[model samples]
Target: MTPVVELSGVHWGPKRQADILHDLTFSVAAGEVLAICGANGAGKSSLLRLLYRHQAPRKGTVRLMGRDLWLMKAPEAARIVAAVLQEQPTDFALTTRQIVALGRLPHRKGFGPGTLDNAVVEAALRRMDLTAFADRPFGTLSGGERQRVMVARALAQEPQVIVLDEPTNHLDIRHQLELLALLRGLGLTVITTLHDLTLAADFADRVLVLHQGRIIADAPPSQALTEATIARAFNVTARVDRSGPAPRFSFQLHG
Candidate 1:
């Protein structure tokens, strides 16, 4: 099967010369959830930005299902890739439903939102369990509620590929698992950045460990979450145990 997203030697950053991602090459197949794991300043956000077309790569190329990302129009690209960024602002005074309905803007023709569009937004809110708070002001919601609303908005886009940056940031334990399970059930090409190693192992089909803007390890969670990799990438010692269906890590603080 053809991969949904592919990056070959892609390098991007603020300046034309300073490259954040150095010769990064990876591909995510359809219906697979790939987690990008790394410590702070590892360029995880930069990679996601490049994939979502927020910033173009200064070198190399990014292709979505064999089509060059740069060659695709903005709306066409937005139609395929939906993103829930880490830094979501709560300053927007719009209601939860209104904020989510904005996702349908790409498909909207005029200023007024249509019934069909509202239906999609409603469905998304239901999926995220935000129906009760749909009419509430988005800025008035709690952090976790706001996070769910953002996810609902992204789902409203109905994109083929979903890029999430710290999606579980403000979610509770139960909601975190539920959201991850929901994403997995969607069978969309998912690329997410997660700080929780255990959650990453449990949810992601594959894990990519980035260090200093380079991919240090790319493999299934069972194989990728080794003691050595964790210690090196995260600067924390850990013991890996596979007693359950998935490998679990117990952190060991270094002296």
Candidate 2:
């Protein structure tokens, strides 16, 4: 099967400063969840930005659905890839439903609601379990609720690929697990940056470990998250337990 997303020899950053991503290359298959793992300043978010065309690579290409991502027009690309990044306060004024309905803007022909758009918005709200809070102000919802509303908005876009940056950040364990499970069930091409190695192992079909703007490991979680690689990339000693369905890591700061 053809890959849904591909990056080859991608490099990006200020002309004078060190590149945020350097010679990074990887691909994600259709319906696969690929988790990007790294320490702070590891270029995980930069890679996502390249994929979604938020920032262009200084060198190399990012392809979505076999076409160059940068060459595609914004709305054309929006129709294919939807993203959920850190929410801003500016979004808080919109109600949960309104926030989600905004996803339909990419598909909207003119400045008026249609039956199909309304149905899609309602379905996305229901899918994200935001129906109960649909009319509530986005600022009033809890962090987990707000996160789901963001996902609902992404879903409303009807995207073929989804990209999330540190999606599980700040959520309690329950909400984190719930959100991961929901992503798994969607069966979409998912690319997300995850700070938690354990969650990445449990949720991602594959894991890519980045260090110093380079891909240090790219494989299934068990291989990519080995203790040695963890130590090398994260400067930590770890006990990697792969006896269960998913690998687990226990870490100690290395001297």
Candidate 3:
């Protein structure tokens, strides 16, 4: 089967700047959950931007379901890929339900939402447990509530692939587990950047580690997140114990 998301020889950066991600080549299988882990400024978010088509790669190609991402129309891409990024809507005046309803905008047949669209929005609201806050202003939500709202919005898109940048940010431990579990059962391609190695290991089918501007390891959590790889990627001594249900990592400064 064709890969859900693929990048061959991809190098990316803003115009006139050095590429921040270099020579990336990989494919994400349909319904697979992949996690990206790296230290600060390891180009994790930069890589996600390319996958979501928020920014085109400076070189090479990005393909979605066997088609060039740049060649697809905006609506066509929107129907296939949804993203929840750190950046948010400038207009916080919109209420929670309204914000999530925006996801259905790409699916509407006419000027506004129809019955099915409204139903989908309602389902997404409930799935994210945002029903109680549906009438609240988006800006009034706490950081974690806002994050869940954004995920709900993405779920409302009903895309084949979902891209989340630092998805666990601001979420409490229970919510974090709930959210990752939910993603696991979604049956869509999931690509996310995660700060928590244990969460990534437990929730993802594979883990990709990035360094200054390139991928260093792309493998199962057990192999990709070894003590050696962690030390190299994060510049700290790491002790990874993988004997349990999930990999646990301990870090120490390199002397």
TM-scores for every predicted model = 0.96, 0.96, 0.98
Off by over 4 Å in 2: none
Candidate 3 weakest ten by summed lDDT: 240-249
lDDT of 1 by residue, 12-104 (tens): 778746777788999999999999999999989988999898888888999998999999998889889999997875557899988998789
Mind giving the per-residue lDDT tens digits that candidate 2 earns over 143-247? 888888888999999999999998887688998999899989999999999989889988998999999999999999888999998998898888997788766
Top TM-score model: 3
Candidate 1 lDDT at 32 equals 93
Ranking by lDDT: 3, 1, 2
Regions more than 4 Å wrong, model 3 = none
Clashing pairs in 1: none
Ten contiguous residues minimizing lDDT sum, candidate 1: 11-20
lDDT of each: 0.90, 0.89, 0.93
Could you tell me how far off, in angstroms, the CA of residue 132 lies in candidate 3 after the best superposition? 1.0
Candidate 3 deviation (Cα RMSD): 0.9
Position 46, candidate 3: lDDT: 91
Error of 2 at 84 (Å): 0.8
Candidate 3's displacement at residue 3, Å, is: 0.4
